[model samples]
Target chain A: MIKVRNMTVAYSGQPIFTNLSIAFEPGKITGIIGPNGAGKSTMIKGILGLIHKQSGDVTLHSKPVAKQLKNVAYVEQRAALDLTFPINVFDTVLTGTYPNLGLFKIPSEKDKSAARQALADVNLSEFSQRQIGELSGGQLQRVFVARAIVQEADVIILDEPFVGIDMKSEAEIMSILKRWQMAGKTIIVVHHDLNKVTKYFDDLVIINRGIVAAGKTADVFTKENITTAFSGDLSTILFSDKEPEHA
Target chain B: MRSIGLFIDGLMQYNFLQTALITSILVGIMSGIIGSFIILRGMSLMGDAISHAVLPGVAVAYMLGINILLGASLFGILAALLIGLVTLKSKLKNDTAIGIVFSAFFALGFILISLAESATNLHHILFGNVLAVSDNDLITTAIVLAIVLIFVVVFYKELLITSFDNTFAQAYGLKTQLMHYALMLVLTLVTVTALQTVGIILIVAMLITPAATAYLLTNRLSHMMIVAAIFSVVSSVIGLYMSYTFNWASGPAIVLTAAVFFSLAFLFSPKQGIIFKKKIN
Candidate 1:
């Protein structure tokens, strides 16, 4: 299980979340859903030690998660990367093998095979030699997913992976993620699509600067919970279609 | 074409010409490799800043009778670190940090040069006198080049990962901050090495122009490095010949050659040039 206990996060002397705690067990597709500026990404960053937490204990299997960050495969938002960087699709995926390769070691043939296999898994084998900047938006997102697959970590964390990609790419990503979940790897996604919340993830972490609710999607994605989380305004506007299944 | 034959003859006959030619080639390779990363990271201004920032160290080294490379490298690394630190700790961006720091160091360099009674020619340090490279300067340039080359080879993957996606690099347990500073150190070393060959004023051009021109022509980083090295070595050799034949300053002449190549690439590169790009409907 992945656990974040007594966590406090602040930005420039302003509190985003305080004394908050959340847990994510293995073998689940978890989506951390929230409105903008609700600390969804910040909470994940804090847990991964990507951002400084004022005070927190983020443990994986009862030990500190920060120490074993290499065991975590983190795919940042699509826009965080430089698409214009002079690298081919295969080379971009090969970077995932680097953390495992360690210092003074180049990617060997075995690592290259893994990268190629990852690319194949993502259905990007034909575009392996193409430059990253030349890829379409959906293809670029798939490239990042290929990178993450080559990481071969027990936990996969993606921040806003579905944004700006086509629906086909979104469906493809969710299916790949489902395969990982079945293999007993933990997956955490920072998502905002309310209609797909119950459909995509088995577990949901709803936050509005703090944990509004966190549990199985059917149990915790209530209308009152989302109304409180989005402060009633966005909940009505956003959840009018699907209504959170049990809300 | 006949002048080129005469230039090759001169290279074989004159030791000074040979020394200048060899030093210019070595300087070309170093700047080409280092500058690839510099432009890719969007730190071209930082490269210019570091090259200029080493001036005060050179001036102070002249005053203290110390090795100028050591002094310049120290000050250059210090300047890079300070810029990184400032940008990290404050709301000021990287360019703002560079402008404030490099100009201050440059002004201080001039003041120190004025205070010193040493015989180190400020004009030579600023504009370069490639024809006057001594045996010791040649050795220094060679050593710096070897070190820079080895570091790049050993850390190629790390540098690529960090430059491409720093956050992912960090998440994968790579120390991005350390990688950044290490690149800065290499940048400083390259700047110090170029001090004698191209001098401070034109070093930025040597570092950026060839790599940028290569960037226009290549889709891969390794290809960019290779193409840039070719451009660098070719331009420097031709520029040296032009200097010898015309009695022009070697640094500016070499920079002019790089600029010419860049112009060609900008207009005619098959993949990215403006002239050949198909207009979208």
Candidate 2:
């Protein structure tokens, strides 16, 4: 489990998140849902120690996060990646083992096998040798997921993992997360799709510049809570009767 | 032909040829490895800019009687760090920052050169004389190259991940800022050493051309690095020969040979070459 306390993050003196506090439990799939500019990604980065927090501490299973780096793996938004580099799928996936290998040592046969298995898990085993630039957006996202899986971390954090992916690939990725949860690995995902929030997530943390609601998916997703968290107007449109509320 | 034979015999007998070969190889290998990462991260322009900026550093060192490599590396790293900071901290685009730094530093170097025209051999620092390479320069190049090679090999995985997906690598607890600074330092040292052997104008060609060519030919970093090293060493040898045979400038000849390789890669490389368009129906 990971814990964040009184976390505040700012960029160039512009405050994004202030006094945010939350805990992501172990062995559950937790969805972070919020409208655009809601500090969802910022909170994730703070937890991962990618960005400096003005105030607050993050801990992983009672250890300082900096000392427990190998316990967590993160799959970033696909948009943040450069796809034109001359890297193959296998090499990309193999990079996930870097933390464990540390500096200087090459990947062993065992690491390569784990990478292959991770590719197989994502149904990308056949594309191991293929150039990453030659892959579709969905396939590229899956490759990143395969990398996270290969990391074999206790916790996996993914930022908008399904964005721009087709429906089939989305379903495939959701199933992978379900399996990860089944395997007792904690999964925290930043998601924009409100429809899948209830179906896929065991817990929900609605964030808006700070922590808005933190509880079970069903409890925190109530109409009143959703309305209050999303400023009421957007919630009405999102929860309209014509649109099915849950996927 | 007789003159050519006599020149070859003279080169073989002189210590300068051996010095040039050793120095060129050191510079080439360092640039080749560092250049691969620079191209991978799309920081080829940064490499080019840093090479130019080192001119002021070398000028100042020549004036102060300091070690040229030391002064150049220090200033180059400072300039690179400043560029990185500006790009990361401010809203300025990376290329714009690089342009500003390179122009300002190069102009400063020119001013310093003019001020000290009577006291220094400016050509040795500007377009270096490989034939005049001292033992100390060789030692310094060797040390810098060895350190750079070790760092690259040791952090290959981290570098690969960060270059491909910096956000993800950072999110996974990689110290991406530290990695970026470390890489910039290595690149600065590589460029400085390369400038001493190949001159500032041609250092960029040596830094980027081999890697770019290898990039066209391979889809793997490891293979690309190997091919780049081979290409760089070949170009260095051929350029040396051309320079000796035709009585042309060594720096321009070396860069021209590398450029020739780049053109060949552009024309004949299998996957990304212009001549071999992907079949899309």
Best candidate, DockQ-wise? 1
TM-score of each model's B chain?
Answer: 0.96, 0.92
- Model 2 chain B, poorest ten-residue lDDT window? B272-281
lDDT score, candidate 1: 0.89
Q: Write the per-residue lDDT of candidate 1 for residues A1-247, one digit (tens) a residue.
A: 8988999989998989998998887899999988899999899899889888898899988889978888889988888778888999999999988878889999999999999999998888999999999898888888888888988988999999998899988988888899999999999999977878878999999998999889999898877998887768767776677656536
Please give the DockQ score of every candidate, comma-separated. Answer: 0.87, 0.66
Docking class of 2: medium
Task: Residues B127-246, candidate 1: write the lDDT tens digits.
Answer: 887899987889988999899889989999988988889899888778998988888888888887787777789999999999999999998999999899889989888889999988
lDDT tens digits, residue span A44-108, model 2:
88888887889999898888887887779988888776777878999999988887887668899
Every model's TM-score: 0.97, 0.91
**DockQ of candidate 1?**
0.87
Candidate 1: regions farther than 4 A off: A231-234, A237-247, B278-281
TM-score of chain A of each: 0.95, 0.94
Write one digit per residue (lDDT tens) for candidate 2, span B93-177: 9899899888888888888877877766667666755667778889989999899878977888888888888876766667888
- Provide the DockQ value for model 2: 0.66
- Give the proportion of true interface contacts each model preserves, from 0 to 1: 0.90, 0.80
